[model samples]
Target: MQSTSNYLWLLSDILGQGATASVFKARRKQTGDHYAVKVFNHISYLRPYEVQMREFEMLRKLNHKNIVKLFGVEELGSTKQKVLVMEYCAGGSLLNVLEKSENAFGLSELEFLIVMECVVAGMNQLRENGVVHRDIKPGNIMRVVGEEGQSVYKLTDFGAARVLEDDEQFMSLYGTEEYLHPDMYERAVLHKPQTKKYGVTVDLWSIGVTFYQAASGRLPFIPFGGPRKNKEMMHKITTEKPKGMIAGVQHRENGPVEWSEELPVTCRLSEGLKLLLVPILANILEADQSRCWGFDQFFAEANDILHRTVIHIFSLQQAVIHKVYIHSYNTINVFMDAISQQTNIPAPGHELIYEGHSLELDLVQQVNVVPKTTEERPIILVSKDPMTPIGITYKEPDIPMFPPKFDLINDANLAKVVTSAVHQLLRITNSLMKCQDFILRGVYWMLAILKEECRKTTQQVTALNVKLNFCKDTWMIIQKINSLLPQMNLTEVGDVHVKLQSTEDFLMSISQNVQKSQKQLDLITAEWSKSNDIHHKDNIIGKVQVLLDKVSAIYHQLKKDRMRMKLQYNEEQIHKFEKIKMGIHAKKVLVLVRDDCVQKYHKLLTSVKDWMRTACDIRKLLGPIGEQVKNLNQNLENCEASLNKTLDHCSSKLHDEEQIVTKLTASTAHLDQKCFEMVIGMKQLKQEMEDISQELQKNNMIIQSGFQEA
Candidate 1:
């Protein structure tokens, strides 16, 4: 066993028994600081190694103020038994506080907020570090009472936590009773391990349960007794509604007295805060896990909540006003100078709406709003454009009057703009097709140049072979004449020697001329073979192979170019189709507006109210226009569908074209192989001619010696 002394602590006694481990109270010998060490047992469950590994991975990485700090870990020499050391809390668990304070002081709103904030802080930290506290309950939170009844809270327990991933594998058995997500129940019944497929929403659901009971002093959904069956618990979690108070309790029927009776609690709690917290909690508890906010969103919201809470705790009015201005941007710049005097606010950007004419406001560089003031400044609200498109008619080019109110978000107009932008993008894409064409032409030119060189090499090689053959014939003839002079017995024929010499001279000259011609022809042939067209020819074969390769490459490139052209053509067609669709949608909307206007014109003839008459006429005209607009939209959708179908067809054709191109490449390679063989044959013929010429020269020399002896 590993020595306990090495861990800088001494185990005083066993603290408690847990589901998967036992907790022991230990104190650091050096500092005398107490800690709770949880020992893990492997054999109690199957696949203990995997479980322990997971636990260690999660616990070792956690670092947060509200979260229980892990001091260290100890492992025995060979056993799977490992001990996790953590900071000890003296105020016991939140469960004890809840039980004691259920009726006494009734758990005030401020107190509940404080405790819940601790839990949220710990959770927020875990989420930022990419961890989840899947099990969040009153028992997991430990409270430490300071002097004069001040309590400090910390979050503990991570046996059920899960890390999120794009495709994480989770074991469904994680989480505890009354806190398990609805998905966990489904997973358990399905007998499947937890998958990292889920987001951080799972942890949020557990936190919601913790927060609900803490504030209301009762479980939001769970039954009051020991534990309910799976069916009962799941029903409550899924279908049960929020109740004002716990059941079967007469005195505490209206919720905790301190929390419920406080008409106005701390300024920290705002309507926005309540509104925000409820939805998050509800979403986390959703039976469908898909809708839950993942860790990314949770962390963002938690930070915002913390920031807001901190500002409130400090009684900083500027922070509260800054938060309000962020939500609503109208008339914010009017107070910019006043706000800047006390706070660190700077000039705002596109997201902010300036409702005043202040050149000075624009001059400032920063955007943070600060300080609180009551003096109102000169305000000028600039209205945004309406969703309804108004036709521009110029009688003498007059500026249009702004509307009384404008929607910052124009849903219909936004869609129209997007459709227009898409059409423009399609045009740009069509232009890029020309680039592909240029590349295709370049590739084609490369192949053409290679093929021409191959042809030239092949012709030169053929000419060389013919010249070699001619030299071979001439050398054979010279040898015949020389042989006759030696047989004529011209031993004393010093005069005969001269005649013999003349014949020898003629033969030597002929041989010399033939040798020169052969050398020239060989040089020409070798130079031709070295061309890029023939990359690898022994003599004739390499040149031939190069020619074939050039032809094949060109053919393949041509086919690819054709496919690319087709794709470009299809894209153009789709663009035209989409434009038509947009035109139709716009026309239909115009028609609707016009029909309504026309109807109003007819009603206005009898109405006493002049404004009503005008409005009625406008609406009447808009009706038929609307019908036309509807038709245009339908036609546009049809065109879009057709274009999409064409795109699919083009994709399928591309695949088929690729296969054909591959086949063409293979056939060209085969042709190259055949050409190589032919070149090899030419080389062998040249070698044979050289051997014959050498033999003939030796015969002529022997004949000259015989003539001198005679």
Candidate 2:
């Protein structure tokens, strides 16, 4: 029965149960090293041996830390099952982190990037080996705790991965529908052959979705109505644009917290974060031919996007107007210059107002902007002048009498500013926490990368070391070879010298390249560490310190303002109390009157006045609420109609352009074919001309010889 107590894998509790196989945690019988064992039943799988053998071959070839390492594969007689042994990943699947922390927290950009780097590295390796992972969902990505107490993510579950051929059979849609590309779903619906080829872009699409959710804690598309309601999800994936969800979404009538404009609750997104994500998402999700990001393009473009900063610029005329967007870092003077260019207002005449006062150009360095995903940073707003095309006017240069206050309203402004500052502090706290967690992950990934590069360098160093010794030996041998000239040919001595020089040059080149690689590694590590600290420690500390002073100043002002407000409130309360006392006195006297009396009438009037005041207070709260609702309605209408119209126009234009491109491509091909034919004919004509010239030259030679004889 091929059963023995000395069997290597001791399968314990089941880790997962899939349709084709059941995975379990195992330990090596001799070594005690932990591993994962996937047992596939012979009956359940089609061509079981073929599949297992193929998987084993691919897994065995893949030597990557990010990819799961295969130890061995075997078949059991009793169970008639194919068992695949793999490295045990203790840190669990990424899905656990995503789903478990739904309420608590989300994967920060640094953390997500760390995971992404691992996944991409693994994928790149697999691609280099001519293999494709059809399934790359979060569940298939797992974290493995290494001996160094560091967690490194790895791409696991190669059951769906296959070696795709260029001119032969390629990948099938053998993955989860949710993570599948829209094209994959379309092909499935069309009942395309399983042998049809699909590119690695399917993985890119899933990566985009994963990135979107990781960064925002929200799905790019709603995970509902899958294949139901006339394949609504499929339709959405194939045709509809991804309508990104709003966080802090509230639904109407105490329903589920789903995102909708009707709910009137909007998630505030940072203008910068939005700008950062839009291009990335466009690369993956946008099905445009020219602008889409290929696999190589992702790595190329990500570094620039990671380092660049985003800023929102505003214009001021009669009212404050938002009009400009700037990328990367710039000083206030530069920003002012940008505004000048955009608004045609000279930088000298116009002043930049922040809070309730003009910003001191000199203190611009102190005003640091920290990029946040949720926070919509309010930049300096231009003052209360109506802007017009011909509205350039020079104001007399004068010193400001009062410093600008930042808030529009006095009491609430201080409270709002203080609240916002507190939120910033909270975000800093969260980011710090995430940084600590992500740093470990980053270190592990960095270590893995270093190990690979250093291994190659070590090999070169070893070779060079050996060659150095060889050169010394060869110098001794060269003297021997020279002496051997008496015994044999000395010509071999030059060959030996030339070979030695070539070897020396080769060693020098390798050494130089290795040094260059080390410098590159230094740059890479520095950049990685800097990116990991997205909100730099110094910046955060400085921001907190600035906000602390601002908050404290506002607190003192708020205290004074509260005192003044309380005094006014107290005076009104005293008047109301006096009126109430009069009303009470009149109420007692009401029994004495029985009929309509002036005192009894005064009580009724007091009751009416109290009701009016309460109503007014209610109105004050609802007034802003009503305005917001009205604006939301207007926005919804305009956005829906305008966006739809714009998209339709763009779609039509794209279609027309595609047709034109197709026509141009065909004409170009025809022209190229004609050019090729003409080139061939021209070559033949040139050959003939050459032959004719050669004959003329021979005849001239003959004629010249005859003349010489005469």
Candidate 3:
């Protein structure tokens, strides 16, 4: 057992152990809060002092939600050895999660996304601070349950991390053999006699390996025995280029490289997501340093997947209510078209109903559909043709209508009319209240969705910018190559130039679409805040409609722009550009450039298509809800107007009664005064009579007294 100044660490509380340090789950004596205490062993001190202090300095300087936070350093009481007190992640490392039998093939789509989001965010934080985590693997990443019970991954173990710029080089070898870059592996593991320096892109390689591991159960590059026993083979596998862009795995020491572009069959990620994810893995896991994507491109592509809207449509016409995945954008029409292709249902002959409201084909999915949809609650498809049987009976909405009419002909009907009017008013008011609450909730939901969209768009824009930067760099290289080798017949340079120019144009167009999306999101955010001040039900509905309209317009335009770019990309002679015969040096550089451009362009196009598809589903889901809100608002307004008119008519009828009551009140007042005067006179007469009777009684009493005296 080791005791720090404020913590107690026992041998039984060991969380994990590495070569240099042992992490122990400890508790603070003062607050009793659990913390992870990392105690470095003497092996760690064997390194240079600066190297030993690197982790502490990095942890102290860095503060991000996705990065493990460092508390104050403490000295082990008995040995006076410095130990790091850090935030404890109860969910443990990502390796533990992957080690589970259920996750043998890979994490589920949701879990994978969570891992991607957290790891990317952590890496982004590291990048922002000009730090490179030389060793990024599943074991180094920790997971903690958030307040909402969602798994939040954090980057831990900065022992191998350092403050290095993107272009800076380091010769020190670090990282797990399986996750290390090919150059790093050649130098460190194989002990190759080369002075090759590693750059910041090394972290990307590790991330690629980690993410690939998370997506699929096994590592990308595996030899017959293992990475450790067959080190040279592993290096060869990592360095060699297969026939196609895919991961390589060898079954034997001298066996051929087995290239696979698809994930394992047991992977829990949907086929739709896999399609988007495979390309990302292919690009990131590229052994060729020149071909591997930068952190920016990786983040963008991953975020694009994260932001994708995958809608599960339930076919009510089917016997068992089968669910199908439809990736679409623009409107419900597109969604139906996709469904039509998948299910062979005529798009025009069927209606899509979600939560009882029939979705319009022309309505945008993102604005009107996605917010209200969930896996459990899918969009219900029903056949409109009477002969075709819908498996589940589609019931009409049971919305009640209220129309109050005032009848002021007689007094008997007055009370009835008032009561009916009041009841109708109450119902309308209650409905309006409910509608208002729904509107508020809808606005918040839309805000959340749009904010996510904005984040996705921002990532896309950043990626495009990165691609633009890459294009510029490649162009500069080309220009230099041309300048230096004036006599070299680089005929392929012209095609490369044209391709780069077109790629730039495509990237710019996508960037503009992203900007438009951001602007629309800003408008929605503004409207959401403004919605609080809008008291009128009709006005609120109108505001929401306008916001949806603007969103729909922008999305349609984006879809058009994407289509145009895709067309332009398709029309290009990519095959002609692929065949380049020139000087060996020039050939390699130009081929790399061409391949990079093609790969990035395809990825961008795929991302855009995925985004648009998601946007459409989201809009379609939201459209019916928006229409409901409008209908509810209209009903509320009609009821309110009718109630007001009835009350007005009743008020007019009561005006005559009010005048008649005034006349009667005046007449009663005069009668009351006269009756008071008559009562006074009667009272005075009675008093006089009483006085006479009293006098008579007194005289009688006096006579009685005289008689008594006689």
| TM-score of each candidate structure, all chains considered together | 0.38, 0.41, 0.51
RMSD of 1: 37.6
> Model 1: per-residue lDDT, tens digit, 1-710?
12255343334466556678877676665676777777766543555566556666787788767877887787634564677878888777887776541211124445766686787777777766767676778888888775678777888877766676533545556666566665675465434455634455666767766766665445545332323533443444343333222122112322422212111221223333444455555555555566566656765665555454211111011111221222222243543433343233343311111221112334233333322322121111111111121111111111122122322123223323433322222222222222222222222232232233333333332332333333334333323322422332213322322433343344344334334434433443343334223222212223323333333333333334444544365554543343344344434333332353223322322221232222223223332433433343343334323333333343344345445545665678464554444344333333444454464345435433432332
Tens digit of lDDT per residue, candidate 2, span 1-710? 12223234434467776767777777666776667877776545675566657677889899998998887776664565667888888777777666532211346444665676687778778868877777777788888766877558898887777876422334456776656666676566545444445666666777776666555444554534323333434434434453433222222333333432111111123333444555666667643323446667776565545444444433322212233344435555665666676556677655443332345565253224423211123334332222332211111111111113322234333343343334333343333333332332323243344435445444534433443443334344334323422333334333444544555565565556545555555554564465445424433334444444444444444445545554465554543343333333323322322332223223323432332233233323332432333343343334323333333343344345445545665677354564454444434433543453354345435533532332
Cα deviation of 562 in candidate 2 (Å)?
A: 51
C-alpha lDDT values of all predictions:
0.44, 0.49, 0.61
Looking at model 1, report the run of 10 residues with the lowest lDDT sum. 310-319
Off by over 4 Å in 2: 1-12, 102-105, 146-150, 165-171, 189-197, 223-230, 242-274, 287-291, 303-710
Q: Flag regions of model 1 displaced more than 4 Å.
A: 1-3, 6-16, 42-46, 75-80, 102-107, 144-152, 166-171, 187-199, 223-233, 236-273, 309-710
lDDT of 2: 0.49
lDDT over C-alpha atoms for residue 57 of model 3: 97
Model 3, 1-710: lDDT tens digits are 77887999788899999899999999999988999999999898899999999999999999999999999898898777779999999999999998653465678778998999899889999999999999999999999999999999999999999999877889998888889999989988888798877788888888878988998777988888988989988888888856335467888668887878877654556555666778887887777777788878888987876665667565443311332334434466666666676456787766565555555544455323544566555566544332222222111112122123211122112222222222222222333333333333333443455556545544533443443343344444334433433543445344544554555565465556555656655655565455444433333233323333333333333334434454344333331121111112222323332354224323333332333334344454333533333343343334333333333333343344445545665677364564454444434433543453354345435533432332
Q: Which of the two candidates, 1 or 3, achieves a greater lDDT against the reference? A: 3
Residue 380 local lDDT, model 3: 60
